[model samples]
Target chain A: MFELQAPLIARREVASGMWVLSFSAPEVAATARAGQFVNLLLRPGPLLRRPFSVYRATSGVVEVLLKPVGAGTAGLAALALGESVSLLGPLGSGFQLDQAAGSVALVSGGLGVAPMPLAARAAAALGLQVHWVHGARTAAELCSEWEGRRVHWATDDGSIGYHGSVLAAIPEGIGQVVACGPNRMLAALAARFPRAQVAIETYMGCGTGVCLGCAVPRTSGVYDRACKEGPVYQANDIRWDVLPQHLHYGLGA
Target chain B: MSGLRVGGVELRSPVLAASGTFGYGTEVPLCDRPRLGGMVSKGIFLQPRPGTPPPRIVETPSGMLNAIGLQGPGVEALIRDYCPLWAEWDFPVLVNINGESVDEYAELAARLDGVPGVSGLEINISCPNVREGGMFFGKDPAQAAAVTAAVRRSTRLPVWVKLTPAVSDLAEVARACESAGADALCAINTLVGMSFDLGTGRPRLAFGTGGLSGPAIRPIAVHLAHQAAQSVAIPVIGIGGIGGAEDALEFLYAGCQAVQIGTATFIDPNAIGKTMEALEALDWRRLVEGTRAAISSG
Candidate 1:
């Protein structure tokens, strides 16, 4: 395991507060696993490493989604194509895709919808029937739409699809559910589903396996480091309430 | 505060930011760089280290843990990409060099030979050194001394040795680094700590049991810094549990020549800047209080 600072090989403002940062790392891309994350060692001068999900992985590049919410993201968003930055990755454990998730419902909030496009693509390749749900505080926050999948969007203000949350919109018949988002949002969904797969967030350090810093309580009675044990976790496995009183990414609201 | 010389350069303050936490100085916002006594950069190895598996970091209350595994482009890559940047900056940039072997250490030191932007060297003996039977050279005085001696022989740059607190006798290692012609010392690297997931009942880290950091490890850092400072003649740069200026002062009172902010940067990049501001405020308060007392007595 290692941590690296990759430069911005290409970046473009895709939306109001969001941009696509393409960093340099070949080994990371070659071994890129679905649902894995890399701690983008951004403006440590301005801020420390910021974790970003590997949105999509190619043979030589890993695409990460960035929302210019803070100093690090803001600096990252301003990078011109080919401007170098540091990226230490591909860090953390990722999703354990179950071809057994025959009929599944995937849920996320705003940019958290990241790991999905590839996940849906992966499940489709596995021939698993999939249904997807996306959430945002507003319609302006939503990113891409899955082409052939049944996509649902929920906005807190009712700007998009559902009025409440994905948990409320969750159709009752699905056997397995997968999700990612704010701790509260994830917490609510975990509280609701209580048996779905989930992902958690935290500020990061080494992005490798040496720092036992992140924590995720498991339902079966265990605390796991979100960095190493998961960015992806089985929903039923987490001890939902043990999350930090103040979660990362200013997502608590 | 006076004898702040390490190797060849003299520093104004005994505190220096530790490597891996502060990138080559420039990584910090420019406004705060001036207050830092010095900056030890992310670990530079012989070859670029494409660090370990993902989820490299996890934040805990008052601190953060990281398993960056000393990720950086090789020293050459650093010189090509990061050094010139460091040269232009006003704050001193001390490069922390890491390797799996003694020769690698010496070789890299030699390669760094005349790089202009580079200031001094931090021997990251916290890692394994070759010719030491795969044992972490930092854990043993003999290996530590041998590795220090080798690197000392290789470079004229200010060489400061970084020690890990996980070892049994830190004093022995301190003395070893001193004997090996080291200039100054960075005390207490990350303490070996880990957590596990009880659900799957598996190890938490893919590498299992990563380093524990942040406020949780502060007291231990202070204890080690004091002990190392007492044991060595060289200046001590204390790192660990340093989330703020008071924590940095705690190290200073314990006798550290300089201090580093590690996990603090994860949560607040301005930790060093804030701490410096806090210290100055305290300094101003002390100055005023002392003046008032003198005037009253007179």
Candidate 2:
């Protein structure tokens, strides 16, 4: 992992309060992969670095999607253009795209969509059919700008796309499924598709293995560091029932 | 340019990574190992520990609270898996030994005593998050000295006792450790703290309370380190919320021979090296004399 000061090369308000920030971190962007994350150091209070999934990376520029949920994130949203921030990343294990046989399904719920665009691109590069499935509470909350080949949308309020929770809308018979969402959503998805790869969420400090803060218990009763052993792990390997079912990201599950 | 010796162990610089912040010294790459005096490994016990549950850390104002419960792979794993790597590093690596009893502390020191990579021992008598042993041995002068003396008798390596700020009399404990054969003292571990999640009506950390460290605790650390230094002749190594050169200078000015970077490493992995780069330009003799004058005048 590399740590460097990257300027705010680009920023956009994607949805109501959600934003997409792009930084000029060549070394970090050069090695970033799907499901991997970057820890951005914030200004002023809340001394710890905030961890965000690598949303996209192109031409020495890396992007991260975030909603101002806490002090650290809100500080990030107030930064001016060209302002530099410390970035440590391309950290943790990424999604296993090569493990797929033929087709790959990228499933995301709400802010869980943060890592799917990159996962979709990585799967496409490997010559696998990429099927993107996204869900949100309503049409206004949906991120429809995914540049994937085929996209499916699910909304709880039925304002657009498939009705009901995203879990009910997922189709069976997909070869390999990679998912990121609230722990409650991922827990249910894990039960349905026991073979799916999931990104678990927990409060983190250091964003490296040393702190041992973002630990998630495994089925074997051993706790694994989410920032090191994985932000991505095989679904069935996680002891989902034991995880506290709370929305870590601001967005709903 | 500025190098010093702490408790007889010669160091290349005065900036060391605090225990629990830098792991077994294996995870940090060579490129990040900038001009560091040394690094203290994470606290280890007699057996492997599972640590606390999830949500173990939470960000407060200018600091963070953590209750990691001293999760580690035990003393044997340290000698087998980590020591070989430490022996090859450019800087000295002190093992931060933790124990539930004085005998346990002595056994840990004995096990690491002549190990190739192990340069010294930093007895962790002050850990607030654990259920037993930890801060218990640190809060009382007799207990703290007892642990220090036990470890001192078991090994030939330099022994540095880490003090907890939770104690009512920080100087009493400092002098007791020095009298008990401690070569040096690391003053001011994290202050005990707690924060609640209003949404869930529950404590943010799974362990209810955790040790608070970061910029918020820097001033307290400086005061405590200064007080400890005044009470004893052994070199004082200051720690608590040290993030930059300014923070390290405060410790140095308060009579600390060296300072350890803790939570700051989480923000920038190169914090230790960066602080060292700034410290390289200082006149060490003047700094120490200035500390003596300031302390005497106060």
Candidate 3:
């Protein structure tokens, strides 16, 4: 819960709108849990604090995957290496990892794969054989790279490893599924297994629970906040059906 | 004597971070705020409300409007989860409790009673409720008094009424809260504002109308703060367009004992701590004397 102004160590353009930002936070990197996010305050105007899930964390470096959709991320991507940005986080409740599970598979889409790279490493730490299954529009979008962990790639264009959605190739022995992506992908995965923990993204006013801008409906006929109760939730717990049917992410019951 | 004795509690610093702007105590990221002041967390309602749809905020000229709709996990969640975290910190994390019904507000206030981390309550009366609740309690003097009286009786914690500038008679409402035994007053919540989306011909924000904040509302906020301070003997905490110590000084000069930092924190979460330091560094007594002499000579 401590706030420290961390020095930006490295910033690289991963893709057109995608960026890889690394900060020096040994305490946060060493102990930051999966699915927890850090709120990045972008200076100037129009944009304020933006919350991005922790992508991957090294000994003293915490990397976040960001898509520059607005002024905040765009400004963040433009920061110099030695520049310091006000970051208050390693916040919000992260993914719920079940250690006793035998076979584990990770499903992700677009920049939604932000938390999975670290989750895979954590799974390896738990001695679980993990399979990283990632889905993107094409080969260019699959920016996730795992060194020793197994990764299975899928793209919509038939341009990558698997020529279909990652949902289509859920391993037969998968005892547990962890996902972060469009709501549609999560719901589809949920419908397939009716079991999986998913990280939901909501454009929040305050990435912390106080604002309550980021809330999703739960099966109990109530809404659960993304910042507090979960950035992650079990498939059956979220009320996907109650969501407006317009967004591409939450489609499919 | 420096500690502000507002009703039942004494705030070490009169200044506080406005609600809905600062997250929980931990969300602000300062190692500690034993120096600056206190933090007012986002609004908490009786039940969990999904709130308004997406595109919740829109930037206007020198301001930003937000119709966040009091999205929250209910007041119980705040007590159960957020309070424990606040207890770990040294500063008082005041909870801003809101609700559609007086009973709901009372229930929330009752729930917060005896909570370890809760220092006080700031009642936000500007929440544009879509449910059974007609409008904000602050808009109507009678209702504001009733709500304030109810929450005041429900908890022993000091109660502060956060007034919205949208009301017709701001003095009437501020006076009502004072009569109802409010400890302090935070005048001028965000003003109602809107923006257009030429691309889709729809409103820029998913919610049609949003609360306007930032420099655009500063004058109006200061005006209300001055008026409210004059109307009641209780201390008034000015809010709006307070991006720095200079802005805060304006509010203090206008008669508010303290001021809050809102929209500015979005750009720099550390704006509060930095501004606090900058203000403390100034020879305020000498500056005040200089300004007094100038005003007298002029």
Candidate 4:
């Protein structure tokens, strides 16, 4: 993992408070995979670095999606075009997609959409058809910026494409499920599809396992660092009953 | 000239990675290796610990609270897995040993004794998150001395007692450890603190309370390190909220011979290296003498 100041190349508010920020981090972008994340050091804001999923990486630039639910995300959302922030990443394990045969479903909920676009692109490059299923509380909160093929939108208020949760909108024949979202949704996904890969959410520190702060409990009664051992894990391996649902983002109210 | 000795272990720089913050000294590769004086591995017990549950950490203004409860692999695993890696590294690696009893502390020291790549032991007697034995011995001078003395008798390696700022008389505990044959003293573990989640009407940390670290605790760390330095002849390795060279100087000016970088690493993985780089620009002898003069004058 490399730690360096990457200049902000682009910033866009894809949704009301949701932002897609791109930085000129060639090293991290070069090595960044589908589920890996970048830890942005938000100085003049919070004391700890906030982890963001790699929304997309192209050429020499890396992008991360942010929903301004807290002071740290708000500060990152307010960064001007020319500003540079300290970026430490390409950290944590990413989605393992090489083994899938026919098709792959990239599922996301709310800000969980951050990593879906990248996962979609990666699966497409592997000659596999990709299905992107996204959901938000309302259509206003939906970030449908992805240009991937077969994008399906789900909303809780019956104001969008599928008038139900993202899980309800998944195509019956969709293959190899990969998801990133809140604990409850992931837990449900784990129940239905035990082999699904999930990117979890946890309050993190150090983003490197050193702090042991981001403990994601396993079904074996063992805890793993969400930053190091994961951010990505097979759904069935997690002990969902013990997971706390305190975070605001991902499949909002 | 930047190299120095702390409790008999030769540190290339005066900045060491504090225990718990640096893990087993195996996780962070971005940390500048050449600039690191040494590293104190995470605190370990006799057996593997599951540590506290989720929401173990919460960020506060200018600091963060964590109650990881000294989660770590047991000593046997450390000697087998981590020590070999340390033996290959170019710096000293001190194991931060914890115990639920004085005998347990002594046994941990004995287990690490003569182990390859193990330079010394930092007795963790001030972990507030644990239910027993951690800060229990640290708060009292007699118990502090007793644990220190037992560990001293168990191992031939240098022993540094990490002090807790939660105590009423930090100096008394420092003197007691020195009298019990501590090779050095590491002043100021995290200060006990808690934060509440207004929505849930409950504490932010699952452990209810945690040890606060980062810039929020720097001033208190300098003060306590100074008090410990004044009370004991043994070296004082300053810790808590040391983010940059200026902060490390506060500890040195307060009479600390060296400093350890903790919570700052979370903000910047290269904090220790950056601090070491900044310190390299200063006169090392003057800094040491400055600390000595500061302690002697008071």
**Per-prediction fnat:** 0.14, 0.60, 0.26, 0.78
Question: DockQ winner among the candidates?
Answer: 4
User: Which candidate leads in lDDT?
Assistant: 4
TM-score of 3: 0.81
Using TM-score as the measure, which candidate wins?
4
lDDT of 3 by residue, B33-140 (tens): 755477788888888766776556555666767877777778878788889887786567778888778988888889898899888998877765344452567778
lDDT of 1 by residue, B209-251 (tens): 4566677788998998889988987888888878677788788
TM-score of chain A of each: 0.87, 0.95, 0.91, 0.95
How good is the docking of model 2, by CAPRI class?
Answer: medium
In the range A1-253, model 2's lDDT, one tens digit per residue, is 8888889988998766889999999998889999999999866546778899999988999999988887778878888889988888988999997644678888888889999889988888898888888889998988856856678889999998899788776667778999999898999998899989999888888887888888888998888899999999999999887666763433210
On residues A1-253, what C-alpha lDDT tens digit does candidate 1 reach at each position?
A: 3344465677655445776777777777777676888766544334346778887777677788878765567767777677666666676777666787577777887777777766776767877787888877777776755534577777788987898776677777886787888777887786677777777776455444323345455665545557777878766676555554343332100
- Can you write out model 4's per-residue Cα lDDT over A1-253, one digit (the tens) per residue? 9987888889888887788999999999899999999999866778888899999989999999988777788788888887989999998999988545588888889999988888888898888888889999999899959746688899999788899889988888766999988788888888888989999999899997799999988988888899998999999998887777875321111
Ranking by lDDT: 4, 2, 3, 1
lDDT of 2 by residue, B227-280 (tens): 999899999999988887878888988888888998887777788888877666
| Candidates 1 onward: DockQ, in order | 0.09, 0.53, 0.19, 0.58
Q: How high is each candidate's TM-score?
A: 0.58, 0.96, 0.81, 0.97
Which regions of candidate 2 are displaced past 4 Å? A247-253, B30-34, B290-298
Clashing pairs in 4: none
DockQ of 3: 0.19
User: What are the Cα lDDT values of the candidates?
Assistant: 0.69, 0.87, 0.75, 0.88
